[model samples]
Target: MNLYVRSANGYRVASVDEVVSAAKRAINRKYRRGQAFTSPKVVEDYLRVKLSYEDNEKFVALWLDGRHRLIAYEELFQGTIDGTSVYPRVVVQKAIAHNAAAVIVAHPHPSGVAEPSAADENITRRLKQALELVDIRLLDHIVVGKQCVSLAARGLL
Candidate 1:
């Protein structure tokens, strides 16, 4: 059965089977269309269902190349209701390990506010700067909630 956590913003739906099915369906759709997806909302929707069982906040980063092709996606960290601990060194290392040319980062807000928090801004800035040293570019940092926000589009990164 699906479980849900009701918050002031909306319901946090949790069901591993449901999330996996959704993600597989999305992946299939993309494969069938022969297109690469760069939309943060689509990615976040897939991840939310995947991570619904975890009560804490979770962050996911998708590493891409210069051609805007996806290399890999990593769940950087998880934290309580307030925040998550992100290590710049680790993030940099992961980018290099994947040989990524660009990156798109995302995190879920349990409160359902897609706006980046002060800490989110700080972390994004730090990651961008760190990745730059390795010649990797940060394409976007997205905050996912009931909706989504893109830091790159907002000129925050």
Candidate 2:
């Protein structure tokens, strides 16, 4: 489903999914002009808007090719309001399967606090290590809520 603007042509309402799809396309276009994934803020904005309406904890991975072109945005895990169990092995496997050169993983907090818990920190560390073994860089683990927290910026990764 997609939402259309009130244009001179017509009127239409798009579903949240459709809006997100459109947003993704626009964002990709902006970055693909020889700037792929160079701005962390852009990625965070995408994640924030993509997961904004989600009420549950949804773990998403943005898989990127060698040149940092976004290959896919995959929601790999879902859990309750508080937490989700993310398997480093499974994440690594998906990265390998996608032949991704790098990945940015994120999870939204339904409570709207973007703070990274100790578990979040630990998982980031583990995932960094896991991906390192395969030569796939774990670019960042973002905690999304009212805002996005980049563990990498915090030196957590």
| Tens-digit per-residue lDDT, 1-157, candidate 2 | 4457665778867666777777777866665433567689888888887776678997889999888878888899999889999999999999999889999999999999999999999999999999999999998999899899999999987
TM-score of each: 0.74, 0.80
> Top TM-score: which candidate number?
2
Q: Over the stretch 1-157, how does candidate 1's per-residue lDDT look in tens digits?
A: 6777566899988576656666667764553322345565565555555443445788777777777676776788888986889998998998899888888888877787777888889998999899999999988887766676788888987
Task: List runs of model 2 lying over 4 Å from the truth.
Answer: 1-35
Cα lDDT, all candidates:
0.75, 0.86
Off by over 4 Å in 1: 1-25, 28-35, 38-54
Predicted model with the maximum lDDT:
2
> What TM-score does candidate 1 get on C-alpha atoms?
0.74
